[model samples]
Target chain A: MSGLLDVEGLVTRFYTEEGVVKAVDGNSFRLEEDEALGVVGESGSGKTVTALSIMRLIEAPGRIEAGRILFRGEDLLKKSEREMRRIRGKDLSMVFQDSLSSLNPTLTVGAQIARVLKHHTRLSRRARWRRAVELLAAVGIPEPAKRASHYPHQLSGGMRQRALIAMAISCNPKLLILDEPTTALDVTIEAQIFELIGELKEEFGMGVFLITHDLSVVASFCSRVIIMYAGKIVEEAGVHELYAHPLHPYTRGLLRSIPPLEGGEARLQSIPGEVPDLINLPPGCNFSPRCALADERCWQVEPELSGITPGHRAACWRAERPAMAGGGHD
Target chain B: MIVFLSKRLLLAIPTLLVASFLIFSLVHIAPGDPIQVMLGDFQDPELIARLRHEMGLDLPLLQQYFHWLGNIVRGDLGISITVQRGASVTDLILQRFAVTVELAFFSLIIALLIAIPTGIISALRQNKLSDHLSRIIALLGVSIPNFFLGILLILFVGVYLRKPWGAGGYVPLSRGLLKNLAHMFLPAVALGTAYAAIIMRMMRSAMLDAMSQDFVRTARAMGIAPADIVRRDIVKNALIPVVTVIGNSIGYLLGGSIVTETVFRLPGMGNLVIMGVFRRDFPVIQAVVLIIVVVRIAVNLIVDLTYGFLDPRIRYGGER
Candidate 1:
């Protein structure tokens, strides 16, 4: 059976003055209904680009060259702009990272939420406003009626983010793409946001495409996760299994880099090199230059993301061999 | 808001005082003497001195300033010495100011009508043919001087087309609205084109900025219609900065009206001030300049108040 979201062979590129930046190159993934799929990637690793591509929001100079974004058994890539718009915010919605920038400063929080309802539903203006307040209340905001009339700047950071979430779920979308939804909040607020997302997911039965760089966040919140590097998916697997045995070296490095809560090494382990420039990436594996086990063969040929275990996949020539000693341990 | 308004108004008293003092001092400090200009070839020292005493010009400069200030407090703006000899400066200014206000209002309407739509279109279609065309038009608008544009309009519409209303003149509102508008149209265009260019460029940049804002992307991601996104998200946000530019440029419009009035032969404040300067009519010049200063302060206050209306984040008084 098909999942709620199945992205196949997605190739998004930006044709800039310097060169064509392969932002998302031949990545494929599936998100089951009512499941939280975490997309973990560093900056410029095509996490946001992948989300934007799914939304068909790539502007000029940045085009989705190839992709089949199948949403709910319907190919979203094949839909027209009008059809895509109707599907967006109704069947599919997205929440951004920076709530302050994402919410219109000039418009009240309630009005912004009401606006989404205005377009997506047949509710009257008053009803839309009432529903907007209800959504705000549902998102754990205090005094929803009074808070709805307040502008984005008037609210605290956490509240603004909640308001944004309220807007995203205003129409009860089947798939909600959250791009680092709580990255700007404090740790406590971040945990609260995830809890709210968890509640909202259960309430709406929505598939969440949660994109972030925080692996711990993904481990705690997502059932499955994909690790992206240099605009490519380096690994994909169940969260628990992947954490127990991270097959790829880059994934191992990311896993090891997370600081231990109690007694451990004073310094955190980090990947050796910078993410390769998309325009002039290494000929072989994108992370080969940074891989300690990279040999002549690894440097000459790029590996396809192939199945290693029953439900785990990794794109590394070394993954076929036994797990490297002294690695994958916190 | 009331507290803000009252504070701004109270602050204006000192500003107006400084402005009035500068007007009085500068007009006095200038070389030309009103008595000499009025008497002309009849340069009798005794008669000139007598007239000077009668007008209080012979008094100590400080005392004369106070006398003038005292008269202004009583709604007296002194008498015009040369432009309209012995005419009450207050009545003369009121008549001319009405014409100037009507002209300025018409120009503002014309400028906004042309600038806003074109600016939005230009920004929406940036780097397109329409955008280039508008940019070119704006450049031409700024390049051509107001007097030259006015004369060109008169030549084209009056001399070439032979339209009765195209010739330089003014018609009172009582004459007929259409006739008055027809007469005011060319002058307004000439005075407004340059302002339209400035505002259009500002609007274009502001719109471009607003378009790139994250909120606009959020609106799009939420499935808001493209037109609604442009209207509700982009345009409203863009208008905030553009309103500031419009407020700041009102002074430019009033200043440009001087040349426009001269070319169009309208008896507005510009013409009155110009004639005042040429004939050393200190009362007319000083009164007109002082009024312009006061109007500028009031416009600024209105602009500040408008910010509260446009963006709720900008709270005034203790409500913040």
Candidate 2:
């Protein structure tokens, strides 16, 4: 089925003093309606950059070099900034990582949310304010009316995250892109925030694109998972299928790294080597330097994301070799 | 809020007392005897001694300081030692105080009007032609002295262009607001350029800093218009630090107005202080300096209070 949002061959780059860093190198993915697509990657894997590129929020020194972000069959890249602005926060909204800093400290939380409503909807000032308080209450913030008048600093970390979620869902957006939303919160608060987001998504019938590095967060929360290495997506599969029959070496390494509950003294496995420098990426497969399965073919020629099985795609050259693929450990 | 304000006001008492004591002792220690200055070129030892004795200057310095302090505490600023024999220093200062206040007020207005927009433009157009041009202009503005700028303005506008309003002069606002403003315009510009330059650089940097904040990105992502984001988010956040700079500059403006007034020949506190210094009018000198100290302190207090208004995080005493 055609997806609710489709990102095709997206390439985002940063022109720094050193060199042009290919932050996101021709990566493609999709999110179906009412589905949560987890983008799992290391810090510089262009996960956040991809999300920002989709949002059209990349600032100076960075530019989206090439991409077609099709939201509801409309090419967002072809839209003007004014048009994009109208699309943003109305059609699609984002929840940023650092909730406290992400919020405007000078403005009250209600006012910040109300401002977005004021821009998109034809609600009067008082109605928008009432809607803001309702959104806050819906996010499970106690004393919503009182809290609405409070500045970001006055609230606890969890409350601020809730406030941020309230703002993101203020317009009942069609798609919500969450960029490491729980990275700064404690584990319990993180879980609560995710639960809140999940509830909001259900209530609003919104598609979610969850960008995170936490495997467990993805394993439990996402329906489909995309594993990225460097600036490219290496694997895409149903979350359960990917976990049960992992194809990509990087994805296997990621699953192995998750510490088992009720364990038998099993050592947590970690991938060797670091993410390659984007400005000076090695030829062929970007993950070759870190992959144990790398052969001359893997080094000499980059593998395209070919379907290993129905609904499962991987870019690794050894994907078809079941002997080397399933939980391949040294 | 009341507690915070009361605390600040109570704190000012000790500050003012210490400042008054310092001024009293410093004036006493200053060279040039008031008696000698008063009877310039008419040297008579017996007459000088009698004059010193009558003025109570013959007492020990500490005693003289306490005497002045006591009088000041009792709302008596004493009399001018040199000017008009026994003219009340309070009345003399009151007569000229309005001019300095008017000049300072206009200079601040000019500074804010010039700096705020230029700073915003320079920051928004950073690394572009407009940014570089404003930086160069700010540099020139900061380098040139107020007096030099006043002289240049006079030379160009008054002497060369022969504009009636360009020359150094003072017209009381009571005479006519527009005419008075016209007369003070050049002086304000002269006095304000450096201050404007200072505040502009501050605003530019502050705006640059504020623009990088996550909230600004959030604002943009929220689909608020770019202009609205700059106005509602960037400018408000940026103004927090810029407000401090602006407030501090008012103190600078007060001091700077001294040279500006002397150059422009306005009958302001700066002019009075200059004359008091030259003629060694001890009471007038002492009182003016003390008043300036009080004004500076009050300005700082106002700045501190304004911090709360600008930043919700910095509420006075407790949360609202």
Q: Candidates' DockQ values?
A: 0.82, 0.77
Q: Which of the numbered candidates is closest to the native, going by highest DockQ?
A: 1
What C-alpha lDDT do the candidate models reach, one value each?
0.93, 0.91
lDDT by residue (tens digit), candidate 1, A144-173: 999999999999999999999999999999
Residue A42 local lDDT, model 1 = 93
Q: For candidate 1, list the clashing residue pairs, or say none.
A: none
Please list the residue runs of candidate 2 whose C-alpha ends up more than 4 Å from where it truly belongs after superposition: A323-330
lDDT tens digits, residue span B1-320, model 1: 78889999999999988999999999999997889998889999999989899888888999988888888888888889999888999999889998888888889999999999999999999999999999999999999998999999999999999998899899899999999999999999999998899899999999999999999989989999999999988999999999998998889988988889999999999999999999989999989998898888989989988978998889898684
Question: Which segments of model 1 are wrong by more than 4 Å?
Answer: A320-330
Kindly give the stretch of ten consecutive residues in candidate 1 chain B with the minimal lDDT sum.
Answer: B311-320
Query: In TM-score terms, which candidate is top?
Result: 1
lDDT tens per residue, model 2, B253-293: 98999999999888899998898888888899899999999
Candidate 2, residues A1-330, lDDT tens digits: the string is 568999999999999999999999998888999999999999999999998998998877999998798999988889899999998888889999999899999999999999999999999999999999999999999999999999999999999999998988888899999999999999999899889888888889999999999989998889999999889999999999898888899999998988888764989989889989999999989989888989999898999987888889999888865544555554
Query: Cα RMSD for candidate 1?
Result: 1.8
